[model samples]
Target: MAYKTEHITQQIRAAREAKNMSQRELSARSGLTQSHISQIERGTMEPGLSSLVDVARALDLEIVLAPKKLMPAIGNILGSASVTSDTLTSEQRKLVGRLERWLAGVRDQFSIASEADTLKDSLALLRHLPLSADELDRLREATLHLNRWQDDPPSRKELSEFAHAVRQLRNATVHRDRDGAVPRSAYALEEEDDDA
Candidate 1:
């Protein structure tokens, strides 16, 4: 299948905007030209695979390709069983494999840990499993450390920071998704008055 350049381009533009980043900022982070990003967003140019990877990296996003299940042909003489199982493309397969490995590692750590706090961290890791496994390994490692700290659980400050970082990462991942994107209505940032 061919790359859906226009769709991906629009998603990138929307994610950038949601993050309150400028084209120049993205260009500087991804080492691409501002004009190039503009053109890509405007649908006048299609970025190469490498450029797309760079942009995703700069935005701390992961690109995942899922198999497009084609509809069975109408009035087919053959039975449905004749159709082979739909397979993910090479890129998609690689990502799935990586995620599975990371999940397995987390499971192993969870099994070894015997503390509620450690289990909670493992649960948190599972909650942030995005489609792309780019950060999965890192999260798995962090959870392993938390598990080892069963005797002395992380401080409240540490847990707060971890939660904030996870939220930021989740925001970056789903910023462009229409249906599953994080809703602003779910969270409220309120200011407190010193006088009160």
Candidate 2:
């Protein structure tokens, strides 16, 4: 089958547009030259794997593969059909405000982690996952039985462990098929599936 470079480039351009970012902004975020990013979005250049990864990271996106039949459902969930920020209920708005403030604080914490020269940024980011209240409660309950469970306020190491656990949960729950392997960049799944 022919590779649809146009489709690939179009999706990248659309993603950047949806985020309201210009090619120059994306280039800054992804550490690629603006000309390269422009070439990429214009379909004049096919990005290398590393370039694609950098761009995806800048967009806070993960490239997951699913069965063709499930694409519609996946697309629906990823679509912005949920209530907009402007329409949020008062309580919902408060929660969102709190979360946004917390994120700002966490960004500082991540910077501090960097200043300290530790791998704490990853932990800080994972701790800020926008889990629902129910999920938060469930995670808290599960924390009691964790092998590294600490006191009411977990230490940096304990927090790191918790973040690792959350990452584990995310990996297990997302991007899995019936047989549990998700490939990357195969336009179509093969009759005999392959793991990427």
Off by over 4 Å in 2: 1-3, 81-83, 87-196
Q: Native-vs-model 2 lDDT?
A: 0.53
lDDT of 1 by residue, 137-164 (tens): 4445454645554566555455555545
How large is the C-alpha RMSD of every model relative to the true structure? 18.9, 10.2
lDDT of 1: 0.53
lDDT of 2 by residue, 1-196 (tens): 2245667667788889989999999999999999999988777787787888788889987666688855533443343223243432354334434433433443343323542223234223324333344434544544443333222444555545544554543333233332224413223245355443
User: For model 1, what is the alpha-carbon lDDT of residue 63?
Assistant: 76
